[model samples]
Target chain A: MDYVEELKKDFRYIEGLNACINCGVCTAICPAAEVSEYDPRQIVDTVQHADNDEIEMLLKGDTIWYCGECLSCKTRCPRGNTPCYIIQSLRSLSIETGLFIESIQGRKQLALKRTIGEHMLKYGYCVYIDEIDTEMFPEQGPVWEWLRDNREQILTRLGASYRQEKSGALRKIPEESMKALQSIFDVTGATERFKKIEELSEKKAREMKISFNSGKDDYFRHLYEGHND
Target chain B: MRYSRNEVWETYQKEIADNNFYFARSCIRQNVLPAAEDLFLKIIGTDLGKNIYDDARQTTCTGIAYHSGIIPFETTMTVVAHLFALMNEAGYENYACSCVTSFGIYSEVLETWKHFPEKEKEAREALKKATGKTFEIPKNLVHASDLIYKFRKEIANRSKYRLTDTTSGLPLKVVDHIGCHYAKIFPEKGIGGAEFPYVLAGLIDEWGGQQVDYPERRHCCGFGFRQYLLKSNRGYSVANSKKKFESMKPYKPDLIIANCPGCSFFLDRWQYVIAEMENTTYGENGYGIPVLTYEELAGLLLGYDPWDIGLQTHQVAVEPILDKLGINYNPDMKYKGAGNSNTDSPEQPSSIKMF
Candidate 1:
């Protein structure tokens, strides 16, 4: 199937794209559009008029990745379309086709898959406290390092359970619940998606001559760092 | 203006349950600002005498993964359905979400299920297959800020310190950044609608602060999930926040409040980054504007200690605001460890002042 047909196969694309009147309301309100050259209207227009090649180019490019998925586009689209949803469908298709590795932004799927995705299956939280460290996330500031060093004590003072096997803030999610969540992921194709990301990323890492080791390895770090400018 | 303010606000009013909440925590908030959730239960349950239960069995709604495109909609829907089953088991009808993204995810899933019964059946079957659990959707799904907004007046009456500046005797100029997910996805789901959500504004106003309307009042804080999660794309994340901070700078707002955990985290942390990168600060005296969650604001007004509420966790110090409100605290205790132990103070940033 062509990229466009694959996108339309998803319900989000169907609901998010009716007919683009090119009203520019979505772009006008989009935060991503303001900061970067990411025009949601142009994206919709491109998809609407594109042949299979154009669709393929978009899937491999950074345009779809630029959307913050804020869904501000849904609030004002005259045709009741959601450009954010369209971008989502495109992103999913991009990852599924392994075309995401073609762009700088799209390649970060490995970083997300390893961190938020893997963290969900392991820790039951997207942003696990233990995963965060000052060396990796210096932007968390000095206070965060201090908080990290004294987390248990500080959190205990503030009344959070904080890895305790009790029912309260930041309490450790039970083993049974984690098993069920993993089962849901496996059954719902997320496990497959994670595997696909790793497989594609591994292939791309070899092509670039970067090491593909476990955890936050050389390839993962390469995709994660640089290009902030 | 094209729309009437009173009419728009009245039209956008949502029905929030008064009490008995099944609290769903945010991963970011719990990890970063643990005191916000801690004080939320204290204020809602102990202070206001309401029934809000927090079950340890509840897991993430997988909104972050769903947004990042790591997980498909089916997975998120199944996860949310599982959460609803937990709520049902706890015998709670009203769902209060600590995270705006989770609130948006829940809103999206519920709306989708309503539009497509087949998807709902799919989610039902998926949940049953995975966990052997049947679910009942909550009667009322609300962001935790909506509940706080609902009882703003009650909270105001109990506030130890109004948002008025103790020294100036004037309402402190406050900027409230409502998370885009809270209303942008489904405007009808949020209070006061998308263009002008009153969730935080109501809190600021009722507690004696003036809400500032800046050019970027409706702009996103730019968490952007993967955009910020990956270091390389952090420029995009921080740049969006920089836009909002630049626009709000001229307003010289004394405080910035956000309902979303991601928004609050980025807005707070990005100030330090911006200050370091650009060598400029927004708040007075080279300190960045004190960014807060609505829960943290309530904690302050209800006279919770700064350290106890985890204000010390903030990158940009809350001491300036604490002083402005005349809330007394031991400055020496700012970095105190759990057992009255004095810890090493963090090295302050050269650009943005830190406590």
Candidate 2:
């Protein structure tokens, strides 16, 4: 595939690029750049001139995964360029092409898909309190511990009707709303994208030495635990 | 586009909806800080005397999913289209969002529509086919805290607590943390723009607190959603907050106020993790600086009972702030019943000198 041609198709990718003077402001201000080797200037240069093979390497590389996506680059760029937006497009192409399965951090896409992706469709909420297992999230602290254990009583005390069939905050979504949401996902191609993630993740799992069985298996655990290093 | 470089902040002081609003809840707020929303509803509806509507049917904004690249871009746009349809069904012209992510996504999607009119037509047609509900674009889209900021003076007039410490008779020090999506994406949209947004600071001023200007004030609370979502990757998120905490530590601020639920969640939760990591604290003894949402701060000053307002749910204890203000809260009931007498209360901090 012509990587540049593929990127040119997304209007966002185009808006994100301007004549690069390469003042290094985005790289200097980027928090991810400070912590990780994710340099916006280098990525911009790489994309601006690199061949299809080089761009494909980026699509399957760790540098693309390092952006926190805070968009600080948008705020500081002298040319009104947004390297963050370009990263978004690169990340999108990476996922669609299943080249994301080639890298460690990119492979963690499967972990995010299984947890947040499935949760978004099923519970209609991201980061559901119940799903936050204490073993996974000991940092939520003891106060969270008590609150999670006594969720219904505590939420009721705070005047939130947790999971009750009522017309207020924290109520369970109705059946029709769920169907409508599902249909939106189906028609908008989110479901297809989701299937791609799962199918590719399973193939990637086989390639790795670790066994993949179910919820947060060894391979899943490795990617979820660290930058797919 | 509406802002002027010459003026102080006349641009952001635009009119906030007083009578009619379709309130959309944030999934993070609904799950993490339920009472913050509860107090918001009570203060706006009962105390402030305004009409607002919230329905169980409103779905999650899916901003997190979309930003994480789990949900396709088209799905988010169509879902937002359905949300607009819901607003039309509710017969409300103003959209008051509760989360920063939702607000940001709405801003992004609206801009998307502006840029790609054809894409807008596609989303509208998709929603029209799925739900058969048509929507007029919102007259104004705002964050819930912006409503409180708009009414800062009025809230000050109604509040029982002042920004001054009653017992000490000195002004309280406060640091304000703005969620990135709140105005970072569109600086003109936020109250004070990207560098100096006053949405929370306005409240601190009107309520009588000294707003501290700290280095790293513009930093993200490290709730880099996808990074923070991964268990092992949370160190980056915590380290970011560590930068903020370290920057502000020298100032000795009384509290940190945040507008975003995710900001409050991470800024609050990460303090404990940092303490565990570094073996030190930012406050007296083991305590850390208390972090609160604007609603929590407003409710506290408005004489709302702390426990009823869900102060107990906070990992960083708020009793010190309450004590500094000379506010009355049942000490034993801080963890037990909000108002009920405690049978087996959680251990209280040693610093408290019981009345």
Candidate 3:
């Protein structure tokens, strides 16, 4: 994929890129700089000079993954530059080039793909990991007991019914929408990736003596706890 | 006199002679049961206590997840009908929510049901066949915020603690981040200056706190479905945070405030996480800004111990600011009933029910 052209399509970021005066102020104030050698100022400098090769290298580097995307630079930049957005654009570009495949974030990437696919398949909603059941782990004791105690109160508060008035009715997804979502998932290789993660996560969970539940809810629950082991 | 769901519910239980009441909940709160139930009990306590029979047939608004594309439209509709059935079961035509999202979902679903009576009928039948009960959205559903703001004066009168800042001799500047579901779902009904809602800000001022005006005050935290998922870029989250932080950075307020848990989580934690990721300084004069939930902040100003309310667990620490204000905070002192009902006070009720 011609990632540069893909990014060029969204020129809003270019406006931000154009505003950079190469001031090291962003770097001086950057938390990532303190924690790691990744420099926002350098990334801005490279992009400003149109050093595509250097930009590509920076994108592929582990340092880019270190960005918390806090936007402090964008908030404080005198030139109104948003290095954070630029870094994201760079990440998308790097992903296209398969450079991201080598990073830890790349491993996490499969989790996203899987989550999107599962949401499309089951809930028609993106399943967040926080919704999963982490009862068995007992990191803080049985999560289910904790949830059980407040379940009624929670449902009443949110006004959600515990059981579907009609359970099976929710299973049916429109053929066309399902296809469209599936195609998107396929294009992104999300389905395959998700399956792999699920298998691997379950395996890891079993090895670690952590209970792993199947289905979208469990997937998201584990994901939320960063327990995709 | 705007009262939070708890304040309203408590008042209802104490004063209202009605037992049949309407109820609603937000999708996000479905996962975080305690917060949701705390608000629910408060609303119930204020409106109709034990006399109010909770209809078991209630369904989810499923708005946030649906809006986020995590849940399908068909599922959302089914959930909507389920809520309607609960209302039918309870035999009440009125409902309320502690969350802006639930309120918006209820309103939207109610309107949709009106527009598509056939579809509504189909859903009703489907639900009836499955649960042996019928459901429908009430003609009058309200966000708890609206109800609370409606009775702002009463709340003020009821307030027990008188807040005074001896050192600054100035009111605390509070920046309000009203939930997006509230502003976007029912613009007109929302209290706190719906369009440019400063109602919460005003309420803060009424509580002896200064409401600070900041740019990007109305922007969504990009926790909106697509934003949180599209982690590769985090473009929306970053942009939204930047706008708010930049707008407020100049004011150098003591704290940034939020109503919703998700928004609070992002605004409060994102700064530290992002700063760590981007290597940037978020604090004023190289110090980080503390983000507090409206409840937490209110509890503080009301003379409630901050530690009791889980203030210590907050990622963006409020210690420096509290210390600067010469207020004593016992990090080890847990709120009397941090996770139990016994902790609920008449002034600051926090119990919530899920079903």
Candidate 4:
């Protein structure tokens, strides 16, 4: 499918992939490299020298998802390269080709899509406080639960105009603005991209003989619960 | 690879607008740290007498989704363009962003537009087709912390207290954690550049605190949007914070100050998680180190009521630092609702001490 060709079409791939000197400066400074098996120098070298079949293997593998997107790598690359940006392009191609499901970390994109992506379109905010379930997030502890329960009263005390008509913290976005945001998503192909993620995730679930109900169902729970070291 | 710090820092200095700002509130900050934004507007507008405005029609920059790989870059660019259009309609040339992620994305998008004019054309056309709103790029793009750094001396002059321990008569040791996105992407866009950013340090320098430089000072707080968003990947997130905490422990800093909302959130909350999971603590006498946003620090220095600035919402007890600084607060009003209404306190954690 000419995966490398499709990746090069993105501007980040062009601007990010300057001549690679294989100096490993980015790897030394990368936070992900410290804790994980991920290495920016190796990823750049693989992409620079790998063949079409080898490139396909990388697109469907787990290495690309290891980047935390901190972009610390961008600041240190002596060759003027940004391995982080190249990783972004690789992730896009992986999702576009539906090869993301082959790896554990890459498959979590569905969970992110359902939570952060859907929330952006529906609530006009990325992380809606009301939607945070304590069971799903035990690390939040009891204080967050208390805060969520007494949200309106506490927000008011802090001078927040929560859910009010206009101005102040957590104010509702107007309907016209929501429509404009929706139109941007539709025009920029994000709406279709979201649909693609769901459809492919469902297909993968069927292949694995798992139940695939929509929105935090059995498959979503499986991916959300699966951890990678 | 060795060079003089002065020669390198001189090239990184960038101009910050003095006043007349159009504020951009963050999605997470409004939910997590609502007072952070409120205090910023109050400090900049009422106290400092600047022309800072917030409009009701503005919305999230969709940066969280964009960075999570759920949405494409074009969608983010179009959404950011809409934000600039709102600022243009409101008659402000300086854009002050509340979220570090949004600030980084804005900087990235603006740089992209400069390098690739065709992409900018596409974004303008897309904005016109969808919202019928036209925008001119902001004359100045600055993060909220940058603005505070610009006026640190003024804030210090008006401060009612210093970051000093009254009992010991010594300056409190402080750790400053700048968001990775703040300067890592483009060093020239930040105050002191990436390796050594002075935005938060400038505040500590002027406000009577010593800035502690640890081994992992530049490490990310590990709120990597994707890593923290997924439940399974959170270990990686917490471990990164643990790395920073371990490195800073030997220095024995009294408090940690973070400029990013997510950094403040994880650094504060994860201390409780670490204590519960590993039976370890970084602060003195079984207490976790108190992490405060830059605005929260400014508000405290100005003698704003503790509850009024939302210190009660933190997982780590702030009383230690407040006591160290000799600031007065009524323990009874810690969890009170609006107009002194009665409220219930959450069951306290067994590990870290809470008020």
A1-229, model 3: which lDDT tens digit per residue? 4445566753324534766788787786554555445788887787777656666676567666555443445545777677766775675555555565444443344345445445545543343223443342221112233334444432333333343442111223334334434443443344444455556556544655655676434434444334532
lDDT of residue B309 for candidate 2 = 90
For candidate 1, write residues B11-37 as lDDT tens digits: 679999888999999989998897888
Q: What is the DockQ score, from 0 to 1, of model 4?
A: 0.75
* RMSD vs true structure, all candidates: 1.9, 3.1, 12.8, 2.2
Writing each residue's lDDT as its tens digit, candidate 2 over B1-355 gives 1224314754555556777888888888887787888788888888888888886778888888887767777889898888878888878889998999999889888888898888798888877777666667888899999999988888899988897877878889998999999888888878878877888878877788888888899988877777888886677788888889999999998899999999899888778777766665676556888889999999999999898898888877887788888899886666564335333433332332111
Interface RMSD of each: 1.3, 2.4, 11.8, 1.3
lDDT (Cα atoms) of all candidates against the true structure:
0.88, 0.81, 0.50, 0.88
**Model 4: how far residue A9 lies from native, Å:** 0.8
Candidate 1 Cα outliers beyond 4 Å, as residue runs: A227-229, B1-7
Query: Mind giving the per-residue lDDT tens digits that candidate 4 earns over A70-120?
Result: 999888887889999989999898999999988888888999998989888
Worst 10 residues of 3 chain A by lDDT: A136-145
- Worst 10 contiguous positions by lDDT, candidate 2 chain B: B346-355
- Lowest summed lDDT over 10 consecutive residues: which window, candidate 1 chain B? B1-10
- Prediction 2: B-chain TM-score: 0.93
| Per-model TM against the reference | 0.97, 0.95, 0.55, 0.97
lDDT of 1 by residue, A1-229 (tens): 5777788788898888899999999999887887787999998988888588888889989889888888888988888989998898899899888899898778888889999999998888898788899778889988888888888777777788888888877788899889989999998999999999898888888988989977999988888885332
